[model samples]
Target chain A: MAATIEDLAQAVFDGDSRKAKKLSQKLLDAGEAPLDIINQGLMGGMSEVGVQFKAGTMFVPDVMAAAEAMSAGVELVKPLIAHEDIQSLGTVYMCTVKADLHDIGKNLVIMMLEGAGFNVINGGVDVAPEKIVEDVKELHPDIIGMSALLTTTMLHMKDTIELLKEEGLRDQVKVIIGGAPVSQDFADEIAADGYSPDAVSAADLAKSLVGAA
Target chain B: MYRTRSLYTTAGFQVQQHLFWQMLTDDQCEAIVSTAEELLERTGVEVLSEAAVKVFEEAGCLVDGSRVRIPSTKIQWALRNAPSRVTLCDRKGNRAMMLENNEAHWGAGYTPTEYYDQEKEEKRPFTLADVEEFGKLAQMLPNIDFATQGGFPTDVDEAMAEVYAFKTLVKTTTKPIVQHVRGLAQAQPIYDMAVAVKGCAKELAFDPFVALHVSIEEPLQLSADALEVITFAAEKRLPVIVSNELVSGFTAPAESAGVMIVALANSFAALVLSQLVSEGTPFITGGFFTNNDTVNELHPVGSPEVSLLGGGFANILRYLRIPSYGFGGATDSKISDAQLGLESALSTLCAGVAGTNVIAGAGVFESGLASNPNLLVLVDEMACETERIMRGVEMDEDRLARGVIEYVQPAGNYLATKHTRYYFRSEQFWPTLMNRKRIDDWAAEGSLTLGQRTMNKTKSLLVAYSPKALKDDVVAELDKIAG
Candidate 1:
């Protein structure tokens, strides 16, 4: 029998990791494409969790467990998918800025980006401007994601962007900034390409900026 | 037993001894202060209301358009009469003071919208039931002295959810409740319920036990609805925590001290307005400041500038002789992992040392975007540890010498001595979940991270906790109000 989207989605939501993985593998083996399993089964399940989360019908641990189950299934099918056919929207570099070693926001953006089909390079906390520039030069990523949890270190982003401009690399990269203190007005003031209030919006913006939406 | 001495000065001021001393020599701090003062004088604070502007002008502050230059003398005068200590009264009659000295009380606060998703985890919106669960959990924790109704519950109507959460909070725990007065229509019902539970008609209004937070986005820009809430709350004699959230480099100034002074001026203006509206209305002055560090230029929480801003605000509050509210236990870390521990510990320690009262920002993750029951347990542990630190080491020669001499001269071990048994428990707050077990014991149980242990503890609480039942009449009234 062909598995329905609801059945696959429910398996992920129920936190049945073994079943979620097995189902995804079986579906792939039976001729269902990997992207279909991801969009219909995994992302669909996460969307329900988000609503429950927003509605208070679910709690954090429940959502966390479900996400883990979904991730397990996704990992199982990832290797079977071809690169060009993977339907990834674009590449983005994300980091928590220097002297401010907080990564929760960056990590969320990463997860959201992955869900939206963007390849993410997570530069861990207290990332120096030089390192970001170096990554930009080497990877030539479409977007640079910078984060800071401290007001003192937030100024570093401005400096980083200025350095990129001085190196004549500003036009090559679209810069997106976020954290507790960031705002759209600030983004404009800092000459950043975009600003997002939260991770979901960040993903949406990433897709839009890359002309993938 | 070791006694924790009060670091607060004789005048009931909890001075930031370290930060203040640092400020004396730090040119950066001095420059920021001067620049901030200039901003205040040149730009002036925008008074949200014409009446508030009139009040300041009449009070001798220089008013030029929307910006009002509040001279340092005026600022100092306004602070002089601000009450240093106020008691927070609970429905059951138990109360805690928003102490004047550096004796801070730590508790969990409202969750931000995006907390759990960043950790690759999911935290759903809070509900009345979840609030009730949180209240029970908070009461069981020795460190959390008070609790607020967690942020917007998605399951129920927003207003109804808030009311139910408050009602459940009051019923479940004896800890003083920090409340918010909804729009004018809902205020009376909230007051009535508070009165029914607390035993005073004006108890919710005048009692220090029920402090209300009034949000001011910018200097002088109080929303009309917020003003109405404050006016109503003040008439009842309740203390108000007049606070502003400044997004430094965006809302105020890029310089840390510059941002602080601007926030301080606005906070002072709000408190003065509150006092003017009704005399003898106790107030706490504080603000939230964050560093704007992002490549996209979106503000994120848990920046060092934010911590410093918090610390600076705590000091100013102490200097102004008002109880201070500062953010603590919040980190930019998405998970209840190693990063959470470090960020929470540092931020809390800073607040504690600065002697903040009404310390908030606990049980939140992902830069205040989400709330976690398990994280609350860990945050409580961090608060307890900070309290222990603020208590400081007993300085008397007898206790210090007793152990050393006894071990050197006497043949007996201090571990078995009378002093050790009496003092050890008081000196250390043994964490309920943080593992301190031997390798063999830890191995036997399968070594668990602090997060796992807290999760287990939370599960046990949820299973065992029977929330305090509200009286039938009260329940009926609450349901009707919620409906």
Candidate 2:
């Protein structure tokens, strides 16, 4: 029997990445659309994972295994996703603000956002506010994610936001801020669209603000 | 209802204690030791060093390539030669800690990538100066018995980090040090620096002020680096803890008995190697066990199973009567929070109750990736609490308080009695971070939580403390060696 999308989802939920990869590759070989495979097979398993994680039925390693399975299938199908496809992902631009050499958190957010199927463009660490505004202009990203580990460097996030407003791109792009010292109040004070404490929440926040969620 | 056990302190003062904590039965311990010995005999450990392999082969262990299958008699021979206790001295030539029966000493982290900056309140890559300040803080803390560099300095040349770290510790703290030398090439410079600080090599070796920490990779593989350091430390007569990374559900089996087998085999291999190098070398053996589960918002370092393994492993060590080490008071949280408090307190208690000698890794958080002075103070307080618990309820007549009870009848006030005044200070656990004030009093003091209080305490300790500087000539010598 040809494995259906439900069978692919079950393989993903079981964290059997080999099965998930093979099944997903088979589905694509059988003339299934990449979008349909991802949405029904990969995301379907992920949604169940979200429920299980929330209900305490799944652990972090379990969740990670499932994510790996989904990522395995997504990696196979995402490249086949055409540029003109109506389901194409919105772009997310990430950077660690000025004077902050720390980028572990920022890099994690980039990796996770990419895993969530966003086209993440990292601007690298210690980026000045002007460079951030320039990247936003050049990229025309749907979302801007800025991070700063130090309180001294966190002011650069506010500067980047103010630059966006000055350049009249504030309404064009939604801004999200995150890091260890960054707080929701700081985000509100800086007039950002949202603040996320970590990578997972940052991905969700970016999705909802871009209307992807 | 508790039976009393009479014990004597190191100072020979008699005390009464009542508590019997056990994580494994006698039969279970015997099974573990014998099985681990059998596992070694059946499946040999991979010895990376060719010279060490020759030494092992000479001792009649069956060698196939790098794999050396150790005989049980070899382990028994190693155990006979190794000391049951190790005495460590401070940099000032003061005897600091005795890693032996009925005692556990606390200390800070040795190797971490990042450090929590107090002024910035954020973690960043550690610099040479950060270690000096952190070492100073550890020296200042009343409960921290030994000091470590706390973080690897990124600013220095990679090869000189260990030497420079030892230099910083020599300058900042008079406490005993635990140094992590990554390779044998980096080992001699640290030893030379310590010798310079303590006058001569023989003097330093006689009453060692520092201990070497070397790691054995799990799945029963001893790396060349660990082998060289153990051999060097054995020849130098310095204490060395040849530890293994026993991450449950990853490295060793999650089952208790199986965990013991691998943990013991790896440690015993190191012990045999150390004895093989130099008989009567002060050697300590233990593994860093983390129960790799994040259930209930706990880090692996803070997980209850690490403590469970610690308690069980401590008993196993006692059963073998080997002076041992155990890890405690670590967390995965980036900042001090409820989770941090829970993790630190539980793991620290397990180490103390299990009577682990040299409870290591006090200041570490973020699963040992980062060190924070605030967490160090928090763990110091936890160590104090562990001391109180280990004191147990004294079962003497005076402690039974018959005279006090007769002096003050029911419904009478003991607060005004001499007994209350005499014993209250020692009997009650006085918390430094915990607030037990009236609600208004707490709010009046800015409504501080325990984390905030811990931070405040850390800052004040740093402010009020000034470690005695080394002599100018000694400083110059250390700097020359460091360079």
Candidate 3:
């Protein structure tokens, strides 16, 4: 018997990445539409994970694992779906700011944004402002998120925003900053568009920023 | 519209067994008792009051001027005369506390000179208003068994502070109080106020609402003022708490055994005095122990030595079958920070484990110089934690969870089961000021620290509080006496 789309969704919900990939392959082999598989199967499971995570029934690692399964399943169907039909809430270019090697907080935000149906370009750790600017210009992402953990490294958030202003790309995207030391006051002082104290709130800030934009 | 009421009441945690932290052996305790008896016969105790000396003289002890040498037989006779268990009843004649066995009750300490203002984050001299507020706050806290005279208020007349503090406390709180007075003169008015609230002196005597605290001056001296209070309290049949503060290496011997001997001996002297004043009087006595800092010479309230000595003395008191009071939940930290938390929690847990009845100094900080209302809430939570720790482990049929275990075998979760729902809340020690929330949720709640949360909780509780009103006649009489 052929595995159904619901089975793929259940695999994603259970955070079974290998099973999700196998099920996604099975669904694609059965001649199902890749967009329908993503929207109805992968996103279907991920939306529930989002709800559970917000309700505190599902913790951070659980959501991260589920998002991993979703990403793996999405990867399997990416070639099958047309570029224009890849449905996401928005595109977000995210990174840990320059001079800071911290990636855990930034990675959490990426996972949370991906779980919320956003296409997150994870410009990984030790991300320079020039590289972010180049990627943002190329990707035309709707939102940009930055993270820094140390009080000394947090000033790089201001430097990154200043570089964005210098590149005349500050107004194009909604900028957000986060980390332990980054407060809402610091965000305003640095002239970033928004601030979030934690990963979940970072994703929510992205969604609302894109919505308002 | 129909009103709906919930059928089941919430089941809160109740600590079962008393935690016994006995550091001294039976032989060691007996040795201390005999040594104390020898000291009573050899060095003797200085009876500052002539009446107290006469009472000792009549008891057939050697009375040489103010020094009355008591025989071991008299000490034994006094110990036998005092009741082993004393109940400090509330104003309504309710058994608020049973000071017996390893049962522990906690309350605020006596007579700190300063009060910690939470909003200002500064220490200030206490006023009469602070006493009233402390009484109300203590009454609100479930862990605080009795309200205490928090500190001597600088705003009131120095001579009348005790009376004013007592008057304010009795009117504001219905819980039993542990009061410390200036002299014997203040004891009667405080008793009169309790009697007025309690309806009569006899009922108050039957179940005394107040426990008079008298401390023996250090380095082997019993003052006349202390004897006056003890005699008055004994005659009124009120419970007297004879707690002696002896700092090791300064007022007492640096070694634990010697300190223990001196402290126990001091307590024995008071016990003898009370029994002599009135036979079979309910009395609580213990050695309140602390250590002196070698470099600074400052007496540190939360030393490990204090706990060991306190525990050893408590064991001796239990051996003698008398209720004991000792210091717990006090700190040497000037602020209610990590040091205060760590010190207060450890000391209080030690005291509770030692089974100190009516453990004092719950809210005191900076080595008993200041009292913090916020720390009071924190210490109360610590007491709740101590109770949970001392509750130890239960091994009954239901607690064994055999049925739940069989139903949910390996790889099966007990969550969402009826058994889990029934027992989960009752089994855990839930804290109010302590945060168990996630980092995100904590940040969303304004990122308040533990101390801040306690302050907010305390402020809200105090603001929303209206103590049970005293009778009009009682109020008039109290005011008259206060004036």
Best by lDDT: 3
lDDT of 3 by residue, B114-231 (tens): 9988678788887888888889888899998998877778898887778889898888888889998757878888888888877788889887888988787576678888889888
Question: In order, what are the TM-scores of chain A for the candidates?
Answer: 0.85, 0.79, 0.85
lDDT by residue for model 1 (B332-391), tens = 776767888888788877777777888777776776667766777777888777777776
Leading candidate by DockQ? 3
| DockQ values, each candidate | 0.01, 0.01, 0.03
lDDT of 2 by residue, B82-182 (tens): 99989999987888999888588888777677887645768888888878877888788888888878778888988878778888887888899988788
Whole-model Cα lDDT per candidate? 0.70, 0.81, 0.83
Off by over 4 Å in 3: A1-213, B1-16
What lDDT would candidate 1 get against the real structure? 0.70
Candidate 1 residue spans exceeding 4 A from truth: A1-213, B1-42, B50-74, B114-120, B159-161, B180-189, B203-207, B402-407, B410-413
Off by over 4 Å in 2: A1-213, B1-20, B118-121, B293-299
Model 1 residue A30 distance off true place after TM-score fit, in angstroms: 91
